[model samples]
Target chain A: MDLALLARLNEERAARRAAVLVTDLQSNTQRLVLEKDIMADPLSALLSDALRMGKSGVVESDGHKVFLTVQAPVLRIIAIGAVHISQALVPMAKQLGHDVIIVDPREAFASPERFPDVPVHAEWPDVALPRLGADRYTAYLLLTHDPKIDDPALHFALKSDAFYIGALGSRKTHGKRVERLQTIGFDEHAIKRIHAPIGLNIGAISPAEIALSILGEITAKLRLKPDGTKIGN
Target chain B: MLATDDDLLRQAEEWRREGRGVALATVVETWGSAPRPVGSHLVIDAEGTFMGSVSGGCVEGAVVTEALDVIESGAPKLLEFGVADETAWQVGLSCGGRISVYVEKVT
Candidate 1:
């Protein structure tokens, strides 16, 4: 590996951009293909599949073997409320290698004492989310259950390329929420993206169990194929 | 502290920039329930100091030993380890898996 190439790879990671490091095992030569340039590459099909699956492996390219080191952006969890479930979620999400960020306008809930060693924003979603730069790799958790905060956050999340957007609410609550979203100009297709009554059907009762279920659903979204089958299973 | 792949790659660059001879070992191939997936990285310096794992601590020792030679010579080496191979029997993957590692020096 060249020092310059390693530096460039790290640079892409810091910027949250996706890149694939292609290494020809026979020649020991290497080249990097950025996500934007994958379609132009000769091995575009293989490269795109690798990027979509976020896996790195060896592939046969024209009778020679080349290793594809897929460097996708690290996944992030932007929990919209600094509440009980969020407290439980912070450490669990971190253990799963997803960076967790908390945002709440209430200074009481969003404090260092409650969430230590985590980045907690004591500002409304409108003020905090833009700075967070939520992208396709982000999973938005609207746990506050407060429309004042979650609704504004949804506007930003729906507009962005965030992969998983889950809101904590009951079916009745979600019905009203959908009506509100419709009034705000979000169509049926866009509004359908939110996973209402969030998390898997784990029959969670306590805060910790709910947190676990939410993470379970997030993991499914991250790992499952488009047809609802597990990837690499 | 769990070190992610991002951290491992960044540390490799840091070690190389500090004038230390560094070699990177990556799991390019895996078979039969390999603990670490492909693209996992293990970085070793000249002093045998290494971080990260390619096979859940089952083969780091062997990979680091091979990496030292890779650091000495600029040439890269492809090492395959499994329970069946004679050379890999000493550090065989207990999980009954096979992994091919690509070890190369950072220039």
Candidate 2:
């Protein structure tokens, strides 16, 4: 690979942009294809497929073999509360290779000492989220259970392309939350995207168990198709 | 913190920018129950120093040795290892898997 190409690949990744490094196995030649430029390339079909599946593999392009090294943006977990669940979530999420950021307006809850090793923003979601900028790869965890904090974050997450938006609450609490969102102009279809009563149907009582269930659900959302079938199976 | 493949690539670039001879080995293909997935990387410098793994440490020694050759020759080589190989007892995967690694010099 060319040094310039390697540098560009790293640059694209740092900027959280999806890209693919295409290498011709026979000629030893390579090219870096940014996500935006894939459609214009000759190997657009193969490149798009590989990018969609978020996997790298060798594909047959016009009878010759080419290896596609797909570099998807790193997945991020933006927890809206620095509560115990979020504290438990930090290490587990990191182990699953997801970058985690904790946000809570409560200074005591958002202290770095409580959530050591992860970024803890002691500011409201509205103030911190914009600076953080949630993208398609971000998973929003509305664990505050405080509508004042979680509602604003939900507004931003609903408007964005965040893949997962889970809010911590009971069925009764979610009913009230849904009513508030409706009055605030969110339609039923949009409101349905928020995974209230968040996490899988596991009998979780402790914060750590709840965190595991939430991560499990997030993993399912990430690796499974909408119909619950595995992606690229 | 676990060093991701992204970190490995960034470290490889940094090593190359420092005027060191660098070779990158990627698991381009895997068969059976491979230890590491395809696209996994093991970056080897000319001094036989490496930072990542293409086979979960099963065949990294052989890969680093081949990567050193690629660094010196500036030619990419595709290497395969499996239980079927004659060197299986030495450097093959213990999981009874086969993997094809593509080793190339980073110029």
Candidate 3:
């Protein structure tokens, strides 16, 4: 029932770290639900459920309704090509609150002169992907048409927990590329996650259009289920 | 109440102590080009109260009715409205879109 402890718990939760709050619902008084007590307390179960689901809710404690708010951290997008499509995609993704990093071995393509505001990594994917350590929130996009540039990145993406992995190319090129991945021991499911011939089926021709389509697909994948239901489901 | 959810909750508590009724409306689902995303919230009180939006005025009237019902019953209900509904044009939204709203009594 300590308000100061509840405020501290809220601050910790806002920082994307896990913290639990217990409340006497009838009195509208709250207590910090610490990690140590999570194993034994029923309220901690609700907190864990909310954390797992990335949801906020009103929980009944004692006899009152206590609002539990959980804030999920932002996701990261690793663009493995500094092409024209990326020029448009980076800013758009940033607007949507994604942390974006552009990577390319070609110094001329991956320069601060081209992308003044965004982070550009002028190293190859082999060196960069390990440093990044892909998580569930990390999305990887291989925009370089060159297999030499994309293949290593794809290998790392396939090994990691990245939610979305897309590679830009024509259908024919993607088919050939899939064959190469198969040779490298990638199974069908792993290759399927690549989203080759990237972007939604919007028939995009211009670079900006292509970027829009890619972002649309990314948004759909991130926010909506395959059945078109919202992600909370 | 000033800003922030805590302030709003405190205000809601004070209103309850003063015998005022309040309802909460949340956007649970949207379909075929909804202007607002799911999980968006709007709150309404006894005296035609309002806060936030569900669908750019497309379903506010329907939400208001639902909110009144929630306030009366003190129970939550999930309501769906779309352009396909016969009365959708009367509410100013007939763009062939749909939304599911969850209405609950908050105070």
Best-matching candidate per lDDT: 1
Write model 3 residue lDDT over A27-119, tens digit each, in one string.
544466554456676676787776555565556666655655444445678999998999988788877767789999999999999888788
Candidate 3 docking class: incorrect
* lDDT on C-alpha atoms for all candidate structures: 0.92, 0.92, 0.73
State the lDDT of candidate 2 residue by residue for A73-146, as single tens digits. 98999999999999898999988989999999999899989988989899999999999986788999999979
For candidate 1, list the clashing residue pairs, or say none. none
Tens digit per residue, CA lDDT, model 3, B70-103: 8887766767778676464355446778776767
lDDT agreement of model 2 with the native: 0.92
Model 2 CA deviation exceeding 4 Å by range = B87-91
Question: Using DockQ as the measure, which candidate wins?
Answer: 1
| TM, chain A, every candidate | 0.96, 0.95, 0.81
- Model 1, residue A121: C-alpha shift (Å): 1.3
Can you tell me which runs of candidate 3 are displaced by over 4 Å?
A: A1-53, A59-66, B1-107
TM-score for candidate 2:
0.94
If you assessed candidate 2 against the hidden native complex, which CAPRI class would it receive? high
- Report candidate 3's interface RMSD in Å: 8.2
Q: Which stretches of candidate 1 lie over 4 Å from their true place?
A: B87-91
